[model samples]
Target: MAQFDVEAFVDRQKIGRPQLAVLLVCLLVCFIDGFDIFMVGKIAPAIAEGFGEPVEAMTLLFLCQQIGLAVGAFVVAPLADRFGRRSMLIFACATFGAVTLASVYAQTLFQLSIMRGIAGVFMSAGLPMALAMISEATPRHRRSTFIAIALAGYSTGSAASGAVAAWLIDIYGWQSGFWIGGIVPILCIPLLLFFVPESLKYRTERNPKDPGIARTIQRMDRSVVLAGDEVFVLGEADGTARKAKLLDVFLEGRTWMTSILWAACFLSMANIALLAAWLPSFFQEMAGIPIQRFAIIALIAYGGGVVGTLTIGYLMDRIRATTLIPFYYIGISVALFAMGQVSFEAPIFIGILLFWSFAQTGGQGGLNTLITQVYPPRMRSTALGWSGGAGRIGGVISPIFGGVAIAQNFSLQLTLTCIAVVPLIVAVLVFMLGRNSYARQAVIASVVTQRGTA
Candidate 1:
């Protein structure tokens, strides 16, 4: 009887149409995800104006949405491990879209916040699932790059939200942003259903008898022939034979490492979410930059994020991520300090904003990629989801921080400086993680070498 190692075959194959199709589908999902999630923040001032409230009043909206996101990441995303990544992803897209569209009809900020909170539950599935799908589909050598390329779509979608707001908010009101965000994802459902395949590794582990595995392998490589009676394997030796449990993330000497990751994610995401939620309002209120002008600046800055995402992904493939990601966070601190100093200077501030986004958004991308590498396929989604869910605690806190700063009339310099501190802390945590990861890799390499010599 013929035996096949599914993961080995995937790693050996070159990037082809099948791989590209996976990337494309993931890219679109990420793009729409970024667009919807960031749209409210991008148009916050407009939404506040429409509701006849101070912009700071939107804090509850941000909080509710984030809490829902935390819940979804913790609860909903892990189900992908059992149910299927593709199916869960499609359901998330459809439900999130419908809820987001309904948000446009909300008559008050409170109502909108409730709707956004509901939408957030479904929206939270996008990134982790996209990362898991892309990671499983691509070759091991190029995994980070493929994940990065898909993430660029997320950056693009985020930037696009600012652009769309700049164009549509004044003409069609804030609802227009929600309208586009909602409609696009619902429309993409057909494409996801038809083009994206479930992770072959997932199918193999969950039900080795699944006939779809044979069909998928054939699609991945048209030239390969498979017998109907072949025995399939994942080539994983570490307890992947059984169903994955959440406890698996902490097993295998991962207890300390998981704690470190959760801490780093908490700090890093707090900073990112705070900035995403309030940067537009910050520049408008503190820097006295007009909303329209800042919108254009945001587009330019988030473009830097796209570049950062791709660059980090490429470098991670070549360099140790432990060594590379910390520098990005350090750069964030420097950029934030420089941004505080140059608040009034458009040319200098824009440059600083670019670097900030490059590091901030890109660094977040790096963290996401690292999570994918840390766990085995059986529990990868659970690890990603739980770590992200932990981070959402910080995300939930960020809006309140921003709101407090705005209410207390904090100086722009103080606010930016305070924000700078979090990234520096994150840098330290990432460095520690790097050391731990390096030590583990070294031990593994030594064992492999000794076994070979013996």
Candidate 2:
């Protein structure tokens, strides 16, 4: 057997316990983030009834939160590089948690919308920071699996929101869902403080000669290392370290690639946001099922997402992120179209939604992992953040647009089937961009290999 270059392979290889633990924390936070976002959709009917308003009222609230996600990911994540990942996470989580709790007392739809938006500002930081921390901590080769697993928590949380909302509404009220959403994150704060260590890569970059570098490195697991070096020595850290700039994403053949990735994100998420926002309503209105029944279907879809994410993550490492994504989108488009045709039979329509959920939701982690690996560590968080922000734009539009189609009394089949085109277009874009992404990565690898050899 040909021997593998252990160091280059190490970062991309399978990870261990500590890395997984931190990933779980990130996943848990993301889970909460997912729940917060999905909760509104699950409880939309209740919220509308409670506020004595139209479903459109909830759309405004949903849009506000998504807008916050866009702004936070685009604007706030870059700042994390300067301020420090640990500090940013601490502040972000606490703020989001508090705002989420306060939302429980919101007296009107307008007030709740504002509170949700404010909460979004904090929750938005969770994924980018978590992914950044995991990217820095895990070996690059194995990073995708760790990321997929963490994001799985997100899907699971979204799924759980349906059940939880149903139970809470029956017992306490719709407000209880928000209360739990807010309070659960508070628990993460202390876990973040206690168990989740600061990114060693971030610390080393901040001050190579700060005298604390050695201590930080020594305290970390010995398995954690850079791609090529005797070891991750502080002063000798990769000369690639520089002030992370957003502009860096536009340089050296990356300008077009960034745009393409952004487009892919936009389309992929549009459907995701739409489905989350409208599924329960669709089931109630079109399928003539009770809202609680629809919630079960949503849970099934979410479960499929978890499985899809893990499966896709494993495949991405072998097949490469670029190659895996286009097919995933195409699969989602097909599955969604099929979903539009099926009746509410237990195995058919539900199965179609599961397939749609599996492909689309799983592709999310694949896309983010691709972005994280493509960018240099200096700009990794910023790239991830902005990409997420771009996706949020799609998310912002998807729900409102879907709501309009439904409100205008469009047939469910026509509305959902037409929506599938968005992902298909995204699939084409992803194919082009994936090819470009691979070529760029190949060039980067060849250059680095030559330098090491020299």
Candidate 3:
């Protein structure tokens, strides 16, 4: 009987039409996911005006949406392990789009919150599943870059939400942003169904006898021929085919690594959430910056995020992630500290904002890439989902923490200095994770080498 190592074959292959197709489709999924996730913040005021409610009334809506995101990451996303990433992703996209579309008709903030919360449940599944799909498909050498490219779509979509709101909200009403965010994903469902292939590694690990494996390999590279009866394998010593469980993330000497990753994600996300929720207000109220000027600065800073995202991905491909990833976080710490000390009127403050966004947003993207690298296929989705879920808890907590600081009338320098401490902690945790991952890889390489010699 013929045998093939599907994992090795994929690692050896160069990027081709088939792989590019996967990347594009996953990018679309992330774009829409980001659009929907960030749209609520952009249109909150318009929605409040329409509902005859104060803007503060939307706090429940934000809470509900965040809680839903946490639940989806913890619960809904892991189902991809049992079902399939492609199938679960398509289901998530379709349902999230439909619900978000329905939200335009909501008569009250309560009703809208319910719809958005529901949408969040499905929306949360898109990015991680997209990451898993792209990570499994791309060659190892370029995996981080490909994932980052796909991730940029999410950031782009987020920026596009503001642009859509500025353009369409005033003219067509707040619903216009939802209209675009909703219709686009539903439209892309056909593209995902037809163009995106299921993870070949997943198929081999789960059911090697499946005939689609042969066809997928042929499509990826037409030169390879596979007979029907051949046994396909992933060929990793630890990659035993079995039912994936949530506990598996903690098993296999992953307890410390997983703990460190979760802590890093939590701290980093908390800092991000605090800034996202309070930065505009902080600049306006404390620094005496005009709201309009801060908006412009914010827009310019987002551009830095895009540059950072792509830059980190490219660098990660060439550099050791342990060194590069933590360096980004440390840069975030320095940027945040400098922001506390610098004059807002200074031209250099703009540069600080740029570096802050570059490091903060890019560092978060690096964390996602690192998660994909650390985990194996069987429990990769679970690890991503759980780590993200932990981060969401931090995301939920930090905004409230910022609210308390604002209520206490805390000074800008003090509040920012407090926030600056988070990334330093994250940097330390990530550094430890990097060392652990390096040692683990060394052991695995040594074992593989010894086996080859034997």
lDDT of 2 by residue, 318-408 (tens): 5656567878888888987787687777578778888887888787778877787677556677878888888888887777876687678
Worst 10 residues of 2 by lDDT: 1-10
Each prediction's RMSD over C-alphas, in Å, is: 4.0, 5.2, 3.1
lDDT values, one for every candidate: 0.82, 0.73, 0.84
lDDT of candidate 1 over 139-233, digit per residue (tens) = 77678889999999987887788787769888999999888878877876787788778888777787665678888899778898887987677
Candidate 3 lDDT over residue span 1-454, tens digit each? 6678887788778888878988998899889888878888988999899899999999999989998999999998898888888899889988988998998899889999998888888888888888999988987767778888988899999999988778888799989988887888787778778988889887788876677889888878889977678777776534345667879888878998989989998998888888988888887777788888988888999888988889988877766666788889999989988998899889999999999999988999999988887787777888888898999999998887777877898888988888888899999888887678543573344234323432
Model 3 spans with C-alpha error above 4 angstroms: 237-240, 437-439, 442-454
Top candidate on TM-score is 3
* TM-score of each model, paired residue for residue: 0.88, 0.85, 0.95
What pairs collide in candidate 2?
11-139, 11-140, 11-141, 12-140, 12-141, 12-142, 13-141, 13-142
The true-versus-predicted C-alpha distance at residue 243 of model 3, in Å, is: 2.4
Judging by lDDT, tell me the better candidate of 2 and 3: 3
Off by over 4 Å in 2: 1-17, 45-60, 221-241, 279-295, 407-413, 437-439, 442-454
